[model samples]
Structure formats: C-alpha cells, structure tokens
Target chain A: MQYKDYYKILGVERGAGQDDIKKAYRRLARKYHPDVSKEPDAEEHFKEVGEAYEVLKDPEKRAAYDQLGSQWQTGEQFRPPPDWNAGYEYSGGFSGDDAAAYSDFFESLFGFAGRAKTGSTGAGFHAQGQDTHARILIDLEDAYRGATRSISLRHPQLDATGHVALRERQLNVNIPKGVYAGQHIRLKGQGESGMGDGQAGDLYLEIGFNPHSIYRVDGKDVYIDLPVTPWEAALGEQVTVPTPVGKVNMKIPPGSTQGKQMRLKGKGIPAKVAGDFYVVLQIAVPPADTDTARKAYETLKQAAGFNPRQHLEKQS
Target chain B: MKNHDSAPTLNGEVLEDYCLSLQQLCHGATAEPEFILQLVEYEVLVPQGGQEAEWRFRAEDLARLRRAQRLTRDFELDLSALALVMQLLDELMELRGSG
Candidate 1:
C-alpha cells in the first residue's frame, strides 16, 4: 500500500502547532463541505479532508504519527516495522466502523477498532460497532426506475496476532425505484460487525444525482427547456418529447409562444405524491440565408400587423 | 456463460418505509435528546408525533438535523439564526434550480 502524508494532506508543515493545523483544516473543510460547496468533487474532497483532520486533531495520534519520521515520501510503498508502536499505549475507543474510512496505512498503525473488538477472545467482552455513512451518486434515470450498483468499502480485518489488515469489500446494492435526491437508504446489519453478542450497526447511504445536461430536479418535479421553431410556436404542431420514463407525443396548442409552460402530469419523479414534469418552450427562429428563406421572411414582415417593440415604446 | 453463484446482492429500504425514531435519530446524529427536542420545538425538524417518545423522523429530517448539528456545534449558530440560514439556503437552491 502507498504511504499517506497526513501533514501534506492538511497542507501544514511538520513544525506547525496544533492551532495552525486546526486553522488549515477548518479552511479546507469549509471549502469542501458537501452541503455548501459547488465543486464537482465536493463529497470526495470532503471525505479526504475529514480523514486528515481526524488524525491531526488528536495530540496522541499526532505524536505517534510524527514518530514515523519524515523520510518517507507521499505514495511511496511502505511497510511498518514490527513493534513500531512499542512504548505508547492506545486506549482505543475508536470503534471499527469509525476507522472504516481511513486508508490502509492508518489502519495498519493505529489498528481497526471494529476488528480489535471483534477478535477479542476475552470472556464477557462485548461492544457494538459504530454506524457508518456514505454518499452515493446516481443518474436521474436511476431514480425513475431502480438500478443496481457496486461499491467498494474500506474496512479492517484481524490477523492471527491481532494485527489489523486493510480490506476492501465490494457489495452489489439494489437501489429501489422512486428514491429522490437528498433521501437516504438504510441497510440494516451491513455496517461494522458487532463484538461478542452486540448487534452490528446500520449503514446509511445518502442519494445524490449526477448533473444532467437536459433535465433538472426540484423536490420531485423535473424541468426541461424544449426548443420549437417560430412557425411551430405560431401554429400548433404535434411534437415528441423526451422524459425519464420514455418518449411521448405532446400536442402544442395554436399560438403557443415562447416561455409557455406545459405540464405533463405524474411524469416527474415517481413517488407517493408524483410531481409534474414541466416543458418550457423556447422559440428558435431560422436564419434567412438563402433566397427562399429571405423571401419567406420578407412576406411575413409585410403581413405583420403590429411592431413587437410597442411595449418598449410605451415604457419609454 | 457461467451461473453466478455466491455473489451477494443486497436491497436497501427507502427512508419512507422505515425511518428513525427519536432515540435512533439521536444516536445517528450524535446529539443529545434534549437538543433534538429543542430543534423539534423550533420546527427545524418537524417530526410526526405528539410526544418526544413517539416522535419519528424521516430521512430528510435526519439530513437537516445532521447539518444543524455542525452549524450549531462548529459555527456556534443560534437556533433562530440557523433557521434563517436554512431558509435562505433553500431559497438559493430553488433559484439555482430554476436556472
């Protein structure tokens, strides 16, 4: 596994004080907070920043981490020396589920709480695992109809000598239909395993939608802008529109102008209370480049009854 | 083609079908029950029970409570100010959605 530099991740020098480390962490946290940040990879960046903060925040963890020396470069292949954690003692309250997010390097040194407790052979020792949380990004179409997804989670395993081994377990999850963004799905008994007789904690996956170029969501409603020619807007025409479910024919009424909204009932997100899908009309005027087109435009101009700029003239 | 045996497939329940009660919400958010009750009183999380013991919160409320925890703990925001910020943020998101 590759060596991870906690100091480098936090953008702080080795000689920096605890206050400086905290200052740097807060700046990064605010920039990458999933709720507020507009960045494309905000969630990933948030998780990584959080991991760095978790290690650097505690004084004991910092001291232990610093003893590893500054010889190793980031991403260098590294293995911890046997008995590396000799003198210092860790009263590990960090449940295995808490350490599930950190990289293998962190797990190797500090040990996974989940694994440590689970592997305990001591009589009458029992501890419940901490619950874990993660965000899952899916396409909007997946919300309309259920889809299957595979995700790899980092976890710690116990070896014979009670050493922690970083393990990546992949699970195929079946996402149910009609789950909108911001809603969470609960997976019972899928999180960190309980120690002794304790019950395993649950896992919660928050849903987020991948950005779609054509459609946008509000609550359960879906919105899209449909382009129509000038003639089609003036004289009604039957048009085929695309929705998450499928394509359907929509009849545009006569004199349907630009900015007109047509609501398709029960076509938004499929939920208990289905939301309507809105089509916002945008008129596209063809350019008069050829002789036939120019003549057609001239004929329309001659036949026009009133000027469109009359409202502007009235305002002036 | 080989038959894929022993491949694990898991199905998760949606938030509407099964949600967290007051005690579970407290455990999940890592907040005390008193604070959650205060939030409920403030209408930050409008739960579906007449009493604290019977209150059940949806996933959306849980998400809001989590955010509220961070704002109040880290940023030191009062409940009233937090409510205003929440409203403004919701409006901002709605405006962005319209565009």
Candidate 2:
C-alpha cells in the first residue's frame, strides 16, 4: 500500500499546532468540498483532505504518526517498527463507521488498537445498512407518456477474499408519468452490498432529462419558444405546436405582443403528476428590403400612425 | 515538478503519482483556461516566478481544471452550457453518495 504524507496533504509543518492544522483543513475543505466546488478533482481532493485531517486532527494519531520518522519517504515500503504503538494510549478509539472508510494502511495501524463499540443493542447486533445510489437520464417523452426502461448497471462485488469485482446487471425500471427533473426514484436493495445478514440499503435514482431540441423544462412546467409572423400575432391564428406527447393546435391570442407567453392546459408531459405547457411567442418581423415589402410597410406605417417609443420622454 | 514524461504512473507515492505542479499537471491535459476562467470568475493560474512561473500546480487544482477543460474541448461545450453541466455534476454526485 502507498503511504500518504498527511502533512504534505494538509500543507503544514510537522510541528504545526492543532489550531494551525484545523485552520488549514477548514480552508482546504471549503475549497474542495465536492458539493460546492467546481474543481474537476474536487471529490478526490476532498477525500484526500478528509483522510489527512482524520489523522492529524487527533493528537494521539498525529503523535503516533510523527514517531514513524520523517526519513521514511512517502509511499516507501513501510513496516511499523515492532510495538511502535506500545506505550501510546489512544483515548476514544475510532468509531465503527469511520474505521470502515479509512484505508487499509490506516486500518492496519489503528484498527486493531481501537475497541469496537456497538452501543445500545442486543448482546451482538447491527443495523443501518449502506444506501445505494444511481443516476439515470430519460427522455422528456418518457416522463410524459411513462416508460418501462431496461437499465444496465455495473456495480462492484467483493469476492470471498474481499477484493472488489465489477458485476453488471439489467433492471427494468418503471418510470412513473410526469416525473420532473431533479426528482428521485427509490428502489429497495439497489445499493451497496449489505453486511452481516443485514438488509440491503435503499437505492436512490436521481432523475434527469436528456437535452431536448424542442423543449426547455423548468420544474414541473415545459416551455417551448415558437416563432410567429407579425401578421400571425396581430391577426390571431391557430398553429400546430409540438408538445411532449404530440403535435397539437394552439390558438395565438389576437393583438399579441412580441415575446408574449401562451399556455396550453394539460398539454405538457404527463406522468403520475402533470405540469402545464407554455408556448412563448417570438414575433418574426418581415424583411423590408424587397420593394413590395417596403411599399407594404410604408402603407401600414402611414395608416396605423404608430409611435413605439413615444412614452420615453428624456427629462434631461 | 520536472517535465519527466508524457504519461504519469497511476499508482504510488512519487510526486508524479500523487501530485504535480500546475503546468506539468495541465500540459496537454486541457484545451485552454480562457473559457474555464469565465465559469469560475477566477483566474486559474498565476506565475510562480522565473522558470517555475508556469510550472506550478497542485493535484486538486489540476484535476478539476482538466475536467473543466475536457468539458469544453472534448465535449464541445460553451461557457454558459458548461456551467449548467458543472452544476448538474455536483447535484448528481450528491445524489449518488447520499443514496
């Protein structure tokens, strides 16, 4: 196993005080926390920082690690000198959940020394299995009309010897109608493998819609910007608009202004829960370059007597 | 910190293995930092001085920078579009771990 230089990871001197170590950890953690950071390796960096703080933040662990000698190169072959931890008394051994997340190298040094504590249970008992998580992107139509999708997932399976092996399986998922983006679908027994005869953790599937050419989705509502001619907007017209389910006739209200939004009830993608569809009207002005078009515009301007910006009276 | 080779070993504790200076880490790893800077509103790289001015990078910084670069060059994403992708990636990872 490779050795990690926690000092280097945390960017601190070996003799750095606890407060210094903590301040560095807090600074780095905020910069790299997977949730808030946009750095590509934020997740890996977060893990490394967490691991570093895991050792250095604790006085006992830090001292024991310092005793290992600075000459031992990082990732160099390591064998803890016999009874290196002999006289060191570690108060409050590592909790069970944390021990499991620590590396084998860490576990080798600290695992055996800690007294495993399982509190307030039967003589011997365990609970709270690991949760399973997955992400799936479905088409907008799938949400509108619902779908039974065959999803293929590859997950790690640990062998009897405890080495992980990649295993693939196919599951048929029932996509409930009208599921919006960012929603979750949970399935039992779809997560990390269970431990010690315990029930498997729940699997959470985060919902995402594939980029659609015809639609833009916003939280239970769908918006499609449709282009209409000036004449079509001025004199109301019925046009065929594309909805998630199918193409339908939508009425453009008379004297509609440019950039006006029109709604089609119950025409959006339908699922178990349904959202409304909105058609944003974009007026397409006819080019006046042609003589016929220029004559038409001249006639209209003379007849209509319209002054679009007449309201803007500059005080200065 | 040196320009040792094009490929870095994926394992072990060598400087090349664990982390590298900014330039070495980003060498050919990304398209350019021009657009990525627009996304974060942060100037990603600054000169360290002399010959090393363009030669500094931390592993954490380089990894995400490279990923951002890939989303633009390899994935053909615009700045606004890349922001959306980055946002979704964060959300996706959270859902993955929590689930």
Candidate 3:
C-alpha cells in the first residue's frame, strides 16, 4: 500500500498542535461535507479527510504514524516496521460504524488486530453488524417491472487469526416495482455480517434511474415529447402514443396547438396511486421543397387566410 | 399468457402514510433512543404522542435525524447548531432539486 501523508491531507505541519489539527479537520469537513459540497470529488475528498483526521486526532495513533519518519514520500510503497506500535497504547479504539469507509492503508496499521476492539469479543460480547448504504441505478423499465440485481459489497471480516480483512460479498437483490428515485429499499440481514451471533444489519439501497432518451420521470410521473404532423395538430385525430407500458391510441382534442400537454392517467409506472404519463405535442411542419408541396402550401396559404404571426405581432 | 411464477418475488413497501415506527427508525439510523428524544426535545423531530411508546416517526424523520446525527458526530456540532445546519441543507437540496 502507498503511504498517505495525513499531514498534507489536512494541510498541517508535522509539529502541529492537537487544537490546530482539530480546527483544520472541522474546517475541511465543513467544506467537503458530501451533502453540501457540489464539487465532483467531494465525497472522495471527504472520506480522505475523515481518514486523515481519524489517525491524527488521537495522539497515540499520531505518534505511531510519526515514528514512520517524515522523510517518507506520499504514495511511496510503505510497510510499517514491525513493533512500530509496540510501546504506544491505542486507548480510543475504532468505535464508529464507518470503518468500511477507511482506506486499506488505515486498516493495515490501526485495523482490528492491534486495535482495542480486535476479536476480543470475550464471552457475551455480541454486536450487530454495521448498516451499509449504497446507490443502485436501474433502467426506467425496471421500475415499472421488478428486477433482480446482483450487487457486491466489501466488509470487514474477522478471520481465525483475529486479523481484520475486507471481504467482497455479493448478493442478488430484488428491486420491487414502482420504486421512485431517492427512495430506499431495505434488505434485511444483507449488510455486513454481525459479530458473535448478533443479527446482521440491514442494507439500505437508494434507488436511482438511468437517464432515458425519450422519457423524463419525476416521482412516478413520466413525460414524453410526441411528434405530430401540423395537420394532425390542427384537426383532431386519433393517434398512437408510446408509453412505458406500450403504445395506446389517444385522442387529440380539437384546437390542439404546439406545446400542448395531454395526460394519460394511470399509464405511468404501475403501482397503487399510479402516476400519470404526459404527452407533449410537437408540431412537425411539412417542408415545401417539391413543386407539388409548394403548390399545395400556396393554395392553402391563400385559401385559409390564416396569419400565424398575428399573436407575435400583437406581443411586439 | 406466460407462466413465470417460479421466479422469486421481492415485495417493496413505500414508506408513506406515516410509516416507520420509532424503534425501526432508531434501528435504521443506528442511533440511540436518547439522542432521538433529544431531537424531539429540540424540535428537530416532532412525533404525535408525548409518550415515547405512543410516538411514531415517518421515513422522512428517519432520514433527517440520521443526517443530523452524522453531521453532529462528524463535525462535533451540538444539536441546535446541527438542526440549523440541517435546515439550511434541506433548503439547499430543495433549491437544487427544483433548479
């Protein structure tokens, strides 16, 4: 694993005081907090900052880390000297459920084996597994119809040697139909494995939809732009509109104009309180390139006595 | 007609209509009841009943309280300050969502 310069990550000096480190951490955390930050790499940077703070906040962990010598370069292949942490006592053990968010470098040093909470479950030291969160992207059709997705998760495992190792586990998750964006699907007993016979924590999967070329979805509502000939828009006509389910014959009311929206109720994502699908009519005017088409247009323009720019002229 | 009943089905229930009891909210957030009670005290989460046993929480309550808890733990902010932070963040998210 490459060496991480925690000091550089936090923008602090080697001899920086604990107060300085704490202030730096607070400032950086506020700036890069994933919820508020709009930066593209905000979450990754936030995790890195948190990991750096995790090591530096505690003096014991910091002392051990400093003993590695400041001369070492960041991203340089690093292996801790045996017994580097021999003298120091890690009083404040890893207590948070976010150990999985920490890097492998952090795990190699302060991971379970040498840390206070290492396999020492002792008798009656049971603990439930940590709840894991992930985002699942599915096609719009998947939301209309349920789908089974295979997802992989990395979790800390307690091996026979009492070493903390990250294990990749895969589970086939069933995504229920009509799941809207930003909604979560809870899968019981599917997160990190519980320690010492405790019940496993549930996995929370946030649903997101892949961008669809033809349809825009909000909640359960779906929208599509339907192209209609100018003649069809001018006169009422029975048209076939494509919906998530399939094509259905729809009636275009008389006097329908461009940018008119028609709602097809109960035709959206199928579910209780089903949302409506909207069809926005876009008038497609025929080009008068050919002589026959020009003659037809000329005949209609003279006979119809319609001034399309009357509204624009009024507005100006 | 097609026979596809052999496939295992997954039933997903939407967290609407005052769903999610207090206990489930606590479990989902991996937070203690005491902290949530404090949130209720600070007006962060307002449940129906005064008594803890009769109190109920919505899925939104779970999400907001968990967000508050994470911010507080990560930034070491107090509940009241974090409540304001949560409020601003909520407004920002709504604006971004609409824009």
Instruction: Give the lowest summed-lDDT range of ten residues in model 1 chain B.
Output: B1-10
Q: Model 3, DockQ value? A: 0.26
In candidate 1, chain A reaches a TM of: 0.79
Best by lDDT: 3
Task: Show model 2 residue runs off by greater than 4 Å.
Answer: A1-16, A34-45, A60-135, A148-172, A191-198, A210-214, A284-307, A310-316, B1-99
Assess candidate 2 and give its TM-score to the true structure: 0.54
Residue A292 accuracy (lDDT) in model 2: 97
Candidate 3 per-residue C-alpha lDDT over A1-316 given as tens digits, one digit per residue, 9 for 90 to 100: 8999999999999999999999999999888988778888999999999999989988889988998899888899988887877877766556577667777788878876445365667877778986666777888888888887766668767777777777876666677777777677777777667778888988777778898889988778888989998789878899998777778999998789999999988878776678889999999989999999999999988989998789899886
Candidate-wise lDDT, in order: 0.78, 0.65, 0.80
Off by over 4 Å in 3: A15-20, A113-119, A124-133, A192-197, A225-240, A249-260, A280-316, B1-17, B41-51
| TM-score of chain B alone in model 2 | 0.48
Tens-place lDDT per residue, model 2, A1-316, is 6667889989999899999998998888768876557788997887788778878988888889888878866787677778888888766555423333455566556655553332223534555455544556888988887766666666645444444335666666777777766665656666565455667665555577888887888767899989999889999999999887778998888899988988876666664345789999999888999999999999999999988877785533
Interface RMSD of 1: 4.8
Error of 1 at A156 (Å): 4.5
Best by TM-score: 1
Q: Tens-digit lDDT track for model 1 on A61-163?
A: 7787888899999899989887677776666535323455566777777755435654676768777765656678888998899888777677666667776
Tens digits of per-residue lDDT, candidate 3, B1-99, equal: 122345444444455535666787788878898898888888888887667888877656666776787888887889889778878887887777545
Question: DockQ for each of the predicted structures, in order?
Answer: 0.44, 0.02, 0.26
> Per-prediction TM-score of chain B?
0.79, 0.48, 0.79
Interface RMSD of candidate number 3:
6.5
Flag clash pairs in model 3. Answer: none
